[model samples]
Target: MAHLGESIDVDNIVPERGDFEALPAGPYMVQITDSDVAETKAGTGLILKLTMEVMDGPFANRKLWTNLNFRNPNATAQRIAQEQIKQICDAVGFQGQLTDSEVLHFRPMRVQLVVKRDEQYGDRNEVKKYSALNGSAPPANKPQPQPAAQKPASSAAQRPASGGQTRPWGNRAA
Candidate 1:
């Protein structure tokens, strides 16, 4: 891939059809029709068009996905390999083989072909982080809720030196 400016690591990967436990329904292709990226940003991005039917396991599948950016886009095959593993596993789903790309038994499917992973590999924690900050409530161990909302001092309390319409507190106009 060519050089591109900084990119957001959505942390979601579109999996290949074969990865699903069941055959993809049909007419499946990952695509990125529209992007929020600015025109000034150089280089292009890969938007997948994964057909939902492709993964025909069961229930109406609804989930979110994302991918982290490569630490070093240029040079460094090891990093490339790591990101590829991250991509493949993330797309197809990996259990973090404890070797960072180790072939995953990936529960349910348990495909033999998988990448081993290191302890810190395939950060499943990214999702957790997203939820922690952006998601709803934080961990129970987290700090307690702070104070409640309070309105600014009512301007009605203070009439500037300049004369202004004034009304008695809680007074009703009959």
Candidate 2:
């Protein structure tokens, strides 16, 4: 056992636990915050684990996770994983070769998520698809035209600054 160096004040702290409920099924804008390459359960394959965070809306900052079996013992699983990787690259407009997963990090993209319930592991969100945040890739190092003096119609009218830069929440601050 370990002893505390100082006295504690439990009464002043909030007692509520964090909500673990699965997010409702739908498309969400997110960015890959982290990625890792690890061995599969059987120890015969490798998987790319990606951790993403919602960028906007009420669920902003919520985390979502997915694993791609890039080097699996099963041929079908490996093929599917490879295809998913390709789709992610295409969505982010990553051309040429991709040797590191970190290249995909911090790029905002849209993901279709569905809730899957398991008796043993509880419910979790599964990534169905990956796409560019907008219909097309964001401008890469190109200058954005300044809006006219007139007020913009809505939030949708706002655009990120040049160099494909965007705030962590996937929007430019007012």
Candidate 3:
């Protein structure tokens, strides 16, 4: 049990309200405030989850989440994940490997958000594309074909190799 130090005035107190509506889908400047890698629930693949915070405009302070499955057996999924990660690295001028522990909050990047809907899960925001910030040239909408000898930054060895447990959002299919 705890005791109150002073008498509280319940009549004058008001509860703070929070907005639950999702931000309208569009291109927004965001900073990666947090990131982590985790295995899928079935223990078959790994996913990188990035928590991004909107840096400016009307949606400032809002949070957006994105997941990239870089270790999946499916080739197409792997390719898509690699492309997204590469776009991010290039946008922020990061070269070489990327790890879950690396600090990615220094610079903000532009990301186009789209709403994804599932019969059972309803609708949620998904990162449809990533681009360089203002004053920088935007990347091609589609990844240009690369030679087999020249590997992209998101190559298997350069991705997050391991983590302790599965992430809550990582279980969803890519």
Candidate 4:
């Protein structure tokens, strides 16, 4: 069990809610702070849930989230997720197999966020793209051209690597 350390004084405390509104759609510098794997709704696949925190600007420290469908029954969905992960890896300069997700954390990357609206769920922010802060990353909307095949870089960063109260609202494919 968990304790609050002190007794509560509910009546004396001000009841103000922190802003739950989503941040405006734009590229924000952020880093993955946490990640975990969970079974998908249908139990047919798994999802890699990522928790990211904004690293700069007025909204510094604000959190954003995304889920990559690591495995899914739908081929399109899985492909999309793989592509998304590749984008992130490329941004962080990781060019080989990603056995662990922890290696992606703590590296500041610029992510293009979009405000998504749904009639049933109001508005939420979706991580549309990831790029390195060095500006070498391709535009999020454009497809990155393929280069000649090459061996994985040997010096790639190798690092060993949420429970969720609610399902994340972003990354829904039509």
Best by TM-score: 2
Q: Per-residue lDDT of 35-107 in model 4, one digit per residue for the tens?
A: 9999998899999999999999998999888999979999999999999998887786665457678877887
**What root-mean-square deviation over C-alphas does model 1 reach?**
22.8
Q: Distance from true position, residue 169, model 1, in Å?
A: 70
Stretch of 10 with least lDDT, candidate 3? 165-174
Model 1, global lDDT: 0.29
Model 1 stretches with alpha carbons more than 4 Å out: 1-54, 73-82, 85-174
* Ten residues in sequence with the least summed lDDT for candidate 1: 125-134
Model 2 clash pairs?
none
Model 1 Cα shift for residue 111 (angstroms): 9.1
Candidate 3 stretches with Cα past 4 Å from truth are 1-20, 135-174
Q: Pick the candidate with the highest lDDT.
A: 2
- The clash count for each model shown is 30, 0, 0, 0
Clashing pairs in 4: none
Q: TM per model? A: 0.18, 0.72, 0.64, 0.71
Deviation (Å) of 47 in candidate 3 = 0.6
Cα error of candidate 2 at position 10, Å = 7.6
Models, CA RMSD each: 22.8, 9.2, 11.5, 11.3
What is the lDDT of every predicted structure here?
0.29, 0.79, 0.71, 0.77
lDDT string for model 2 (1-174, tens) is 789998799889986534567899999999899999999988999999999899999999998889999999899999999989887876775654566888789888899999999889788889888888786774342334555775467644664444555434333233
Off by over 4 Å in 4: 1-7, 11-19, 137-174
RMSD of 4: 11.3
Q: What is the lDDT of residue 3 in candidate 4?
A: 100
